[model samples]
Target: MSSTKRLLASIHDVSPRFEAQVDQLAGVLENHLGKGRFAMLVVPDHWGAAPLREAKAFQSRLRNWSDSGIEMFVHGWFHRDTGQHSGAANFKARHMTAGEGEFLGLEEATALRLMREGKALIEDIIGREVAGFIAPAWLYGKGSLAALGQAGFALAEDHWKVWKPGNDEVLAKGPVITWASRSAMRTASSLAFASLARTVLPHALDTVRIAVHPGDVSKPSLLSSIDATLGRFARSHRPARYAELS
Candidate 1:
């Protein structure tokens, strides 16, 4: 690990459906890192309900954020895992996430189409290129992995690392410290892990990745934990853009 440490922060599931919560999370991040210092993982359509194309007001907000130098990354299209899975994909689909791994079982062609469409949609809306494509829940199947390179995404991230999609090169290797508030068990575990990470990550890794979601705003405890975690890391790692890793 390098002597200097960097912190990469991002808010996932950015969409009109979670507009209010997204605002709250963004505020929290800004309080710690300042406006436009973090990235956003935007979902073009969340659960087939909230489509960015129809949300003109939110579109303006996205444009403003982009203009302010906040990097945007295209998250999964629907952010809902609907395809049937087998083997390891099946296990991940069932155990790793609650039907939110949108790209976990897609075929290469299907994944490619969604990736291209999402990239185009976000780029057109923001009037600039997105930083990368990160699948919802940080889960990708073999097909999605293949399609990622074909789609020409500059970067991508999984649970354990961030990498360049164009050349299959690993950029940063570290666990993304994130919170889960869907269920009590998940919330407790995530909180515990975040606490532990705050104590260990600053010394263990050269780059620390911390990600938050809209749902996290609903839980005050999660919000506090997020603040504490960010505060701890802010002391040891300089706030950094994902592009720096590339």
Candidate 2:
């Protein structure tokens, strides 16, 4: 491989919880060598019966990552069941079920309120302003573009490209992830394969995007695929630092 492309991998989680797996992911990247140069999408301590106390832990840990120059993108206001989405989902949607999304049922007002509060809370906990918003399932309903501008974030990413808020210029363009839609199937990389295909095909592209979820990693095949993806990236370009790009 001639090291023609680079990668940006982001991990998502609901805060004040899942700290273990989240940290384990950090460890995985650290142990994976140069992979530490990637990023982590920090989700908020979303509404629940009581506030999650993990924000404090998130704060301390975030500082270390920040100081080390790790990238941080806001995952969502609440990684909860919004019961709606901008568009519809087939019963087999991977990240969104009909039960989730901006069109599924999320009220525009409530979603914005959560976005405002979540942004405030994450910045308060981390002691730094978050840079972007990634809706749960990457399904920021048709109403979300305006909400994002109001949320005070600077970047937005999905299956398409990395974009600045309120702009059409895609900082990067490519598929973000790969997985089976139904249960019990092994892992795959639509992005990696596409990236590879582009390495030779007529519409050759020079960038690759990688998105990771804790669940996708626990599986052996997916984990290995992720490793291979990182391995390719190691020689391609200095793994990008999130904050630097945004």
Best by TM-score: 1
Q: Write the per-residue lDDT of candidate 1 for residues 88-203, one digit (tens) a residue.
A: 88899988889999999899999999999999999999999999999999999889999999998899999999999989999999899999888999999999999999988888
Clashing pairs in 1: none
How many pairs of residues in model 2 come into backbone collision? 12
Kindly report which residue stretches of model 1 are placed more than 4 angstroms away from their true locations once superposed. Answer: 1-3
Tell me each candidate's TM-score: 0.98, 0.78
- Cα RMSDs, all models: 1.4, 4.0
For residue 234, give model 1's deviation from the true position in Å: 0.6
Model 2: per-residue Cα lDDT over 145-216, one tens digit each: 666666667788766777877664567776665443235533344435634643443234456566666665
* Residue 228 lDDT in candidate 1: 99
lDDT of candidate 1 at residue 220, scale 0 to 100: 93
